[model samples]
Target: MNIQLKHGADRLLFGMKESDVKALYGEPDRKYKDEDKNVIYLYNDKKVRLTFYQDEEFRLGYIITANNACKVFDEKVIGEEWSAIMPKLEAKGIRAFEKENFDSVDNYFNEANWVIFQVEFGEVIRIELGATINARDEFDWKF
Candidate 1:
């Protein structure tokens, strides 16, 4: 699928309702609710996790995936070396920066497109997307 990095899972986007997510991905492998009542949906088979905030009208708040076969804008992201993906990201005008005290890097086209790539031994092991108020605050402070 021609998944855009700006969106969440292939067809999922930020702010989508929980029912919509369920319709698209089926039942989650597991579900959790935090003190704040935010729901976390884990789809182990798909290697993806989604978090929705009840305070935010049950809108999607986060998407994280470790699936190596996942594609972003038709480009294979997982399992690819940073060197191979850097140019593609840059070509899309996405700027990347290494996070302090972390082994991962963050890439963004904008707030809605913010993504984190966790690296270990020079390979991207995980990818995270979506917006959290706290993250936006920190991002604003940094930029």
Candidate 2:
């Protein structure tokens, strides 16, 4: 499947209702609620997890993916060389840069767009996409 990052989150877009997610992804491998009562759907087999928040209504808020089986921008991101992926993101007008970490490196593209790729040994291992509001602050607190 081709995953689009323009929708704030991958696969599941922002403002998508709970039912819309079920229709598109079918039943999740596992489902649970967090301490805050936010719903989380886990597709472990696909190495994907989706988190939704409910306030007035339920809507998709975050998407975390570790699998590279799907294509993004027509390129296989996971396990691909960062050198190869950087150009593709830039071609899409998404500026790419990296932050060094002790263990794994974080490559951020379009910071204003909130797209991040966690790299290890020059290969993408995880991708996080969401809105800035949904992201946790430096204090480890969510807004």
Tens digit per residue, CA lDDT, model 2, 9-53: 345676676788888889999999988888989987788888787
Candidate models: Cα lDDT each: 0.70, 0.70
Candidate 1 lDDT (Cα, 0 to 1): 0.70
Q: What TM-scores do the predictions have? A: 0.78, 0.77
Clashing pairs in 1: none
Give candidate 1 regions above 4 Å deviation: 1-3, 103-112, 131-143
State the lDDT of candidate 1 residue by residue for 1-143, as single tens digits.
Answer: 33455445677777788798889889999999978899999999889889887877778877888887877768887878867877787798776555533434533223445677666656666788865344446321111
Model 1 clash tally?
A: 0
lDDT of prediction 2: 0.70
